[model samples]
Target: MTGSNRPAVSSGWGNLLSGANLVRSLALSGGVALHAVNLYISTTILPSVVREIGGFDYYAWNTTLFVIASILGAALSSPLLARAGPRGSYVAAVLGFIAGTLVCAAANTMEIMLAGRFVQGFGGGILLALAYAMVRRVFAEPLWPRALALLSSMWGIATLLGPAVGGVFAELGFWRGAFLFLIPAASLVALASLFVLPPRVEKRTESKPLPIVQLALLTLAVFAASWGGMGANLSSTVVGMVTALGLVGLVIVTERKSRHRLLPAGKFELPTALGSLYMASALLAVTVTCTEIFLPLFLQELHGRSPMEAGYIAAVMSAGWTAAAIYGSGLKGDRRTSAVRAGPVLSLASMATLAAVMPWTGADGDWLPLALICTALVTGGAGVGLAYPHLSAMILHLAPQGEEDKAASSIMTVQLCATAFGAAIAGLAVNLAGASSTPDDMDAANAARWLFVTVAVAPITCLVVMNTVSFKGADHAS
Candidate 1:
């Protein structure tokens, strides 16, 4: 794949008109929606199921194990897709997913249920990353943006409807019913995938072992993020956080010295096109994933709303995301860059408003809880919707020649990790707030406030890097 082969609208028909493109698009879109609904449904059931199964003693592992497996699966996607190709990979993932579903459907013990969720997450992570990577190879350049937008839109819709849909099923005593039906959905997607995804080009630029060390670093980072949510102490959490940073540093050094770089050689040495793309993508994912993780909990716990209400509120978030994504896609010039730049500020401000008003809507009852939640949802959701796909597209565009899949998978890995990070922070805040913490109110607002401060800080690093760093051949066009 030459530089010209990279996506930049060259066709009158665009890739969107092709038969294979449409089929793959639907398959990818549907597959993602299925997995998302499954997850949301499972989560809705968990809060209710804990009493029937056991107490909080074994509860945290439900999320913890799933996230850990997801990280590992995402890290392995490039390798898996490379070896299996899209057809074989999707088939194998779906089959594995079926097995996990069965485990959950028949789960008599909490351990078995958690294990099923872990495997489910692994399949989900691989499916998402590989699907994004497959888009570059299978579709035409000009149409990639629209295709990505479709994919992102799929996410917003799934998130909006998933919990509510799940709640309906869960309330019907069919929490397991969701996954039972998944067998057919996965089967259909697998069958359809074989017909659409293009064959691999079979090019060998360099054969390198998967970057095991960097993979370890990311795994550790994911662990720290999840562990922190388990209510580990400040000092221990701080150490875990630092360890994650250290692992990241080690990955940089290792990638710099190695022949085959996992995260792109340009991710090191900073300020080149590679670093810019990475920063933009990582930040975009950081905000969006964080928003999705917290919104459900916030609406349900803080506002005394049911899962259905929370799901409806989640749609508002999706509306902001979709509207902003559509707006960002058409804009030219600074509109593009500024949206990326301002994303963090908007996210931070929303968090600020959320923290300030949280007490008013606490368990004691104050003003209109529903209205305040909608406002918070719109602000943060819009900020994320505004930025995620645009940044994602830019990152994919900057991928090294012939390595678009790696770039996509790598970006998804960052997102998966960051999502767990944000959720971990939220989980920790809730646990530390203790049993007295009421659904309407809790003192954990201060902890939440501090975490928001950290989340807000994520993007400001881009500004610092832009000003302070230099690379051999990067030109900042804006």
Candidate 2:
């Protein structure tokens, strides 16, 4: 259903922060916070997990499977919300998350850990989608922007607390405790949601039919890529990657022809402005997943940093994103367009810098390489931050008149799909470099180098594709 077309009231952040709105705000944002924090926590503790369970080969699979399951959960969110209502949906999601966390805490094998992650991701995805979906339902029109900003800020908070909590547990050689730690927090959020959120939406619209075939195709594509990465030889990797590419193409074609759509019209056509924005967003998202999925491992292995140090260092990227997005949000006219174009340039430079320096085994007591790594991480993340807000705004403004909601929802879907694929590709790179099978320093170094180099292509491709995205009418939208 589309949002109300009524003109927004002239309300400010104060309006959203006072009275009953305050409780509603906390309830909604808390759901997103749980999901975001869990994601960062998993990333921080993954290296420690592999060390104990000995499945370095499937390291990236943790992220890949989680994200794929998340996509499915997100796709099902609307139906769940319509059937179960906000309080019920929130409680159900929390139960799933708690179950998954318990399984993770008890897991003795990498396979079991992966299964837990998949379940956790499904719950997290539903929580995330519900938070965003409920905003339009619960908040006044004037409060939408403020509510969204508050929700988005949860990721920034996650960056701080997630690493600290997960890192401490990993440092203490009790990585499983990190998973268990989430249980109480999630329970509290669920309790708050049950009390604060409405049992049902005032206006219940029928949920649209799911794009099951397209989603299945997308999932297969990621699995195919991951499978190839796990293969013993280059030929197998080639065959797997090619097969994945074919499946992706089929997904696009199927979406184009299908009555049940995943994205708005023209989203798959690069010549269209909406299509270009989606492509640029997807490409930037890929760079993010590629870096985040492996950064902690690289830092711990290559720099001999402790888990706490590596986790904190990895979080610099999220800090940069939060800072830059706040700054970029205030830009206007030519300045905004410039920020959009500059995003890829900075990302390209950061990726190249990472490729060059990440492989180096620095001298004892030297901190220069680490400094450069952090700088590159910040720049890479800033690249996305500067461009993403504007891109999203433009997509909303330019979407087919009747399909704005579809366009809005598809943005998150596209991001999750790209993240899943990026993780799979990164696993392939690390495996091909032989880093997963061996503990050799050089192999790890080579894996770091090749991974950065491979993901560098995303920004380079974004650079070329972004230029075609015209800003002629974009300013009006902003």
Candidate 3:
């Protein structure tokens, strides 16, 4: 049945959650877990695959395209749910996601793969928005927080399994295997729909056109950020750069000057502390994600570690993050402060440790490089979990009343942009490091040393930024 067939609103969360509602949340969770796993698996596997395919220049474009497409996809979900109803809309998204995954598996070139990622991002983005939309429209407001928290937990599961799944397949020549998980996962979502999701509802519709031009502008901004690391010698890169600048200019002008705005109007001023916090999260994400991209390749080529070993280290990082998140909530005010402050320090230590102690070759010295690498990874992960959740909450609190949605969206946008920047920077740095003739073990160590040293600078800058700014006067409202 279509959305026109059901009612608009339903009973309280207590009623829905009392009996079968638990299972319903679980159903959504299952889909989220599958989605998160897909994201991580791809992140880990794609770097190596790109080496095989030989297309480093396009990395930013690929990620940027997906981010912009996803934003549009999320925006579209509101209307689609109103028109097609929840069940139809959700099922359609999953099918589209599945088809996109298939295209990724079959893609024979960079262009094709990028197209697949765009489609996959579009579908998955809608699926994500739909999860939130359902909770908003159907579940009682009181239960909403718990519902969202449960959805977030899936990302934790992804942190653990994504690398493992991606690494195993990379070893087995199964780049396509990553998508296999999605196939059954999609089917399971369909099956659970009969039991878990709320009854359908018909919403009023408007004839306003979809925001394609604005979206295209967003796409251009993303592309520019991704390609900015590369110089303007190439036409495509130049175009990408200009588009990003123009789009950003438009976003700023509209946000401050226009009565109608895309971001929450008061985001820049209402909670200055929160704005800093939000930006900090994005910067941290950039630092960490770049580390993730380079660390694997660095291990494989620099220290001669196997894919499995690199993956295990990645798992170690996740384990540390999980531990920190679990414990971070338990600490007192001062302890929380220490932990929060420790974020930048620990991140800096991680980079400095890698730069100083790294073994360019297995014969570098008597000391074991792997041991130090493990310590760094653990420290880095713990720091991130401590800082990120607080940052997110702070930003949301800082937003104007009823602007939480924009705040949340902005968080994702900043994060996506940061991650893209990190990847590009790492790619450029490593590429340059490798440019000279093959260096000896110590020389290779120097290259990595420089790279890690460069990475360490960001947190130090962040720490300074934090201290110089005082938050004593701002009114923090979440």
Candidate 4:
């Protein structure tokens, strides 16, 4: 992957926003936004969901199963797009999403809702990856950066809207309506893709078969951890962690020998640049997921804040992430290196701050403590923002020739796996810290402390792991 094969950065956003490019960009970006928003919207609505559906024991499974299914979906995207072409794949994905959302909206039990979520994840994952996959397919080389930026912006847009939409519906005692709301927007994306996206995309013959065994192992790992957390017992938790770790080890071993690899070559070698970058990204994602999945619940349950307020506070981290990413993209040379190193440092500081402040009681009215919490969340997010793009770029720099696409797509898979594992581990920490106790009890406070403290290891370790990967020769262009 030389610099010439790389897509040129757009001189301005002007070309991407006019004529056919505008519509194509919108169709791709809209799909990503829909997927991203759906991810967070469920977080806001899950408490209401559990209340209505009686799935308190399976709370973490919401994210766990969805993410696992997403890994499958993302893995299948290349082949699906090849066989179905852009239009066919887009329509199919949208239909799957719509059907799943309908099932969720109509579900009467947690089991039924989770089933719906699986279908939605399968579809949403395709849509998310497709947004990136289509960038080279649909746009001129010079416009790639603006196209990529537009797609990236969707996550930020989702952050702003997802929680608010879910919170509004939850507050109104119409949590089901939140799922329903996604259906129409998705339908519009389908319609837009039908007209706007090229009917036929060039299909690659090198599409690999799905690594079913590896996927199964990854799924089992997540299931083990989630099941352990649900057990809410020390023995079960430890057993589950060990089992999950065992499965993960099998995944690594299998990836090394598999014909179709889930990760790029040499990723298993930790001391190498590619290996270190992948590890750093995975660890960063784990830390981020811990905060995203559980923070709102903590704020609401512990501080007596309204659902809307708690949701917004949780969004503070995402706000920081989006802002810093955009700000960091313009950086170069020494500043970029500084930002990369500063990321984990800030992340560690935020987690430590959260451990101290999150466990406290009766400070809700002070406003100062709440402000501090938001600042901590933002700083933690900022840390990831500063480094993520650089880490991503380094992956491209190190990807084995002819395997760049696999390498790029695998980044999402690695991140999703980390998220699933993180959520399960966070659940375990919460349970161990006494999440079963009432929110006002000391046990619940202990749970908050444990959750933040445990997740902080991800960043602390990330700092050390990333330091070995020298990014001095990175291609900073799109």
* Top lDDT prediction, candidate number: 2
**Residue-level lDDT for 415 in candidate 1:** 71
Residue-level lDDT tens digits of model 1 in 216-308:
777777787666556557777677667766776776787788776676546655557666656655665565556556555656665676767
Better TM-score candidate (1, 3): 1
> What's the count of clashing pairs in each model shown?
4, 0, 3, 0
The local distance difference test score of each candidate is 0.66, 0.79, 0.63, 0.78
Rate residue 94 of model 1 by lDDT: 71
> On residues 365-422, what C-alpha lDDT tens digit does candidate 4 reach at each position?
6777787899999998888877776676566556776665556566667777777778
Q: How many backbone clashes does candidate 3 have?
A: 3
Global local distance difference test of model 3? 0.63
RMSD, every candidate, angstroms = 3.9, 3.4, 6.2, 3.0
Residue 81 error, candidate 3, Å: 7.1
Candidate 3 has a TM-score of 0.75
Put down candidate 2 lDDT per residue, 140-227, tens digits, no spaces: 6545545655665677679899888888898899999999999888888888887877888556667778888987988898788877
By summed lDDT, which 10 consecutive residues of candidate 2 come out lowest? Answer: 1-10
Q: TM-score for candidate 4, please give it.
A: 0.89
**How much is the lDDT of residue 389 in candidate 2?**
63
